[model samples]
Target: MEKKKVLLLGGAGFIGLNITKFLSENRDYTITVADNFSRGKKDEYLIKLLENPAISMIEGDFTVPATYDQLEKDYDYVYMLASVVGVNNTLEIPHEIIRINTALIYNTLEWLKASFVKKVLFTSTSECYAGTIDAFGYKVPTPETIPLTIEDIGHPRFTYAVTKMLGESGFLNYSRKCGFECTIVRYHNVFGPRMGFKHVIPHLAQRFLANETPFLVYGHDQTRSFCYITDAVEGTVLAMENERSNGEIFHIGTMDEITIEELIREAGNFFGYKGEYENAPTYPGSVARRCPDITKAKNMLQFEPKINWKDGLKLTLGWYKAFFESGKESFEKAFEKPKANV
Candidate 1:
């Protein structure tokens, strides 16, 4: 039997690299990770993983349509994880997000038309329906079928969501018309080791290590369900392999909804800091509460998230702690104040 050929479009990213590691380690998947390494150079984590003979890397700005020509025509599975994400990016460079993400989606779809890929899984986000839940009082544990809404279409923060909605519609419609299978997975707050510095978990870890007194907990009352990266990767692979999932959308997240206050103080506990915490305002256009109802995934993929938020938080906190202590500051440095003009 021939080994499966897999292409991870942004494979060098946090989640993408984890998926590559999982597949290359335990399975016979010859993997190719094409990423521009915008976050930074290939870290030791990715460098060690790519040491496997079955894995390879390609560096290019995939937003450029010409980049797709560098890829091979035949792949059993293609994981579309490439996107300009991060609240900071959306606020600072909303137009760029629109330009790059839309281009990536268009180019990938065009490439697929001329390629021989059997299946493509376009990764999505929970942000797409945040407005539906927060503004309209949709059920707490949101399902994939809930109508996706944008509270403030003019807000910069929503540019990411807008592009994601486009990808969902574009990929499914393309698969239908172009003769290929497509699956969509809207990730809740997926986090783990090496998830980059811009996310809340790592930022908290950095602050705790810095021993900031009166630590401010932004949006202390807001809630989110965070899925560990490993669990997320497993759910993604299952979505692709399970033939029953064709042309279907799955919410790939855990049911553990936690608050910003709890997550912050918990990190403080992990770092052995008994510092005081103060409530602070979260970013604009942020949803008040968000969690995914993954019933479809449970029923169809038998996907169960094993790592709880607390345990996952501990692991992530430790990694970030070690990372900051090692004098590596690029990730946190990237989380700068959003400027009025890009």
Candidate 2:
């Protein structure tokens, strides 16, 4: 059997690196990771991956139109996971997020239309489903079928969600008109090792480790379904391989929901630290509840989250502990002063 050729955009980030590792481990795929080093991994993992004969790396930015010209060569699949990430970062630079994400999708679709790519897997986000709940405070586990009509997006507002919504629409429309295979995975709060402290879990872990006082919580009553990184990688790979996923949108996350308070307490317990919680002023763009109805993923891709919340948090906290102990100057530098806003 011929090895499948894969070009993964943003392949150095948390989720992208995991996907690359999994695909390369099978020894049946030639993987090229194109990243701009915007959020590149440490040399340790990169060197390990480089040792695999099937894996290669390309340093480039996906937002540039010429970047697509470089990727004009044929590949069996293209995974567009590149985006301006971090909620605070997106809020701070909404224009950059919208431009890069939308441009990258358009460039990839154009390249695939002119090339021999078998499929394109575009990673979307659960944020796009914001404001779809009922007035009775009944929050439905959002299915892919829900309408994406919420459009009031901005700084501390709908920055990331709005950009991701546009990216999804661009891919769907291009795939339909240009006859390119496309799959969109709307991910919930995915947590794991190497995830930046911008996320809730890591942010809390860093603050607790630093023994910060009055640990701040935003929208403490809000609920979210946090998916482990491993589960997310499995679902993404399954979506890429499953033919039935073409032109379809699947919610790739754990269906189980937990409140912000419970999530913070779990992380605190993991670190053996007791910290008082104070509800912060609600940001302009925080949701009350977000969960996925992953029936489509399970039925079509045989995807189910294996890591529960407790076990996953334990594993993540363990990694952070080891990272702190390793005395790696870079890791220490990265964790310096927790950014409360993200």
Clash count for each candidate, listed in order shown: 0, 1
Per-residue CA lDDT of model 2 for 36-87, tens digit only, reads 8787665688779988888888888777777766664778888988887776
Which window of ten consecutive residues has the lowest lDDT sum in model 1? 333-342
Q: List the residue pairs that clash in candidate 2.
A: 154-158
- Name the lDDT of candidate 2: 0.78
- Point out where model 2 deviates above 4 Å: 134-138, 151-156, 329-342
Best by lDDT: 1
Segments in model 1 whose C-alpha atoms lie over 4 Å from true places: 335-342
Choose the strongest candidate by TM-score: 1
| Candidate 2 lowest-lDDT run of ten | 332-341
Q: Tell me the TM-score of each prediction against the true structure.
A: 0.96, 0.91
